[model samples]
Target: MTATVTEQVFRLPDLGEGLTEAEILQWRVNVGDFVTVDQVVVEVETAKAAVDVPIPMAGKVVRLYGEPGTSVAVGAPLIAVAVPDERYREEERAGSGNVLVGYGTGGGGGRSRRRARVRQRQDEQPAASGPGKAASSSKSDPLLGPVSALEGGVSGAVVPSVSTSRLAGTPQAGEAAKPAETAGGKASGPGRKTAAKRMGEVPRVISPLVRRLAEEHGVDLTLVTPTGPRGVVLRRDVEAAIAASRNAETAQPEVAPAAAAPSHESAEAERVPLVGVRRAIAEKLSRSRREIPDATTWVDVDATALVELKESINRACPDARIGMLALLARICVVGLRRFPELNAYVDVERQEIVRLPHINLGFAAQTDRGLVVPVVHDAHRLTLAELAARLRELTADARDGKLTPQQLTGGTFTLNNYGVFGVDGSTPIINHPEAAMLGVGRIADRPWGYEGEVRLRKVTQLSFTFDHRVCDGGVAGGFLRFVADCVERPEVLITHL
Candidate 1:
């Protein structure tokens, strides 16, 4: 039976937990290409992980809403599918069943399914300034849009421009500009409008994320030049303003930057927007540096025993293969049990050191996407064999970029094995909120005192970085020493068993 055809528009469904937006990585199905139910139509990268999204209905893709690298907000139009089935529901509200980790197709596919109203304030009619030159009104902040510079050597949105000084009644330096009075004796003119704009006027911002970003960085939206069409300010505009301000502040006196040298070279450079995983890494690492006062301590350890033990175990049962990282993870679990202070995070608001009931161990894994730390929840509950299997599965998933938000978050402690890169040791930043992290260096045969004689033995360095607000040097040193001791003599772990 031939069913009737219908054009259906599908919005990007909810990406997953804690992720509000995703950058379109690639479109699996192109326009005019037929797709099937539960078929992957696009791949998107969020801050946490990358996952493929599937369409709910079988149809020919009539239109793909966003292009690759476009940051599509949830509930925004993603694609228009022309399907033969009249019974198919709108893919925006209800997509095919589970498509990715943490989130999937369902009612209200996107968080904000209500499309943002695209408003266009009259195609900016800026007042002219000089002869034979296009000029822009500095005070005409229509929809918080951008205004290009006027003639006679002007740059970015600067205060007291020709238009603003002429029509806006520009005040003198250090003088508070009072609102100009009109014929009716009411506070009128560009000055009053600018003041009122700051007070309130329902800013025509389409995304709340933009507003939040500005607030976080203490950026004044008015001062930033809007580069989007029709004077609309985009995120890139704000970011550029931020970079300019930073450079101005850091610039040295008596030595101006190249831009100051009035050259014919345009003051533009290629810039890649920090979006998706890269953005997440920047924010998180910056937070860790800003908030956590961490200290690192490292020690050389003899790993000959641990190495031999792993080889013995693997040889005894090849089917139950174990890895050195899993072994280190086991040691961490045991150490946390002995000293539970390291297995918790600080609550800043309550001024409390909240200890967690379970240990969710996060291990660092580098992938083509980026460095992701996939967590193994409830590590304390898993047996050594189970732990090994779980770690193997997680490492594979992380390398594959298939980890979900649930698997990437909720980590109480972190194990960073930097040795895979053949490095000796590193003072890695403690993953934020988590109290401490243990880093393992490369294990190599080194000369060590064995029975009062120098002998070449397997050795490695263990570095531990912990939040200073947590337990002091005593507890941190004790934890590191214990791990080193266990690594040197694997039999000592039997005591805890």
Candidate 2:
């Protein structure tokens, strides 16, 4: 019996709050592989979490868009699945309810379109859709797709510190476009516009920076054309256009010398692609600096009492030893109760300060995978002992890269214990969307005035950064003072708890 044939395009879905796209970490299924409903097809890394995506229906994988390590937008086509015609039609009628935020039930089937597979070179297998056939005939592994040219020998002379450069016309580390090859196994070169012309339309070009570069260089994108993977215009493509223009300008010799200054500087720099977690952190931290009007206030506190309290607790209950961070976090929860405004967020869109009822406290933890803040939810409800246990657990999880999206977000307040790093003080930038962050510096023995005499006491510097829009300095001072009081006299926290 001839089965009815239908194509289903699966697009990348929103993996977490505020996530625009995700890096394709790995693909569990290959083209021509038969996958059943709810079978995990790919694992993606979002900004705050790593998520596994499962296909919503049964089908045979036909094509995979983009390669592993490439970032795919939320609504971009991920994979195409071919199913029995009757099943696909039924699925269209009775669409699955497993929809993602910012996406609809139909999954944008109206935009479901596919491009012709790139022609491969000799020694590569022919493209086939089902099991027994290869996905591409390129030198690259058919399943992994073609490796970006940037990975071959491009060192990103544009950015040195990180792997990828963000400069115009430079390939991001590991994510440069895979150039199409000619019949003789040579790059088709920039002038070739076969991929764009074959689509019978202007290719859907993304990348705001590419457009901006084109504008700055006075080059029309359509006129320049595309040679990047899937006919997308890349930074290098725009740069090439500008270079071509400059070569043309030599004949005229009338252009300003100022235009050449930037090129000289660019030649000296190394470029790296801001990808993966590094890219996310850069974007979030930049947003925090731009949006949050923050103010920092610091004080030196005698942490002798707090330190003694911790020792006593650890001695009495060795099983659940409370660390300094746990104690400070406990003190922070108490301080927030007295200064609730500091625990709130500014809703600029609504022009209001939101007072959160629960305190999901996030503590800064430095891990191998950059800096992360693993949160303890409903921290106000947890006992001091429970708080210590959960803090340790989350800290370990963060280091192990096992934290979930929920564990990393929804924090009403943050505790940054840079003290572990042996630093004295830091003017903390407020974690955006949250009103305040408490920074704890290293505890050291310093001469202090105690009982009308100078004596050696354990002292630490505490810096508190608050969103100025949430409250004035008066509230900020009050919160910091309350926390200092708890550190000076651990007995005070006992009364509040």
lDDT values of the candidates? 0.69, 0.71
| 142-217 per-residue lDDT for model 2 (tens digits) | 3333432222211111111322222222233344233434445444554334543443423333344455566766
Q: Estimate each model's TM-score.
A: 0.62, 0.66
**Which residue ranges in model 1 land beyond 4 Å of their true spot?**
1-10, 16-18, 30-38, 55-63, 80-276
By lDDT, who's the top model here? 2
Give the lowest summed-lDDT range of ten residues in model 1. 113-122
Alpha carbon lDDT at 342, candidate 1: 91
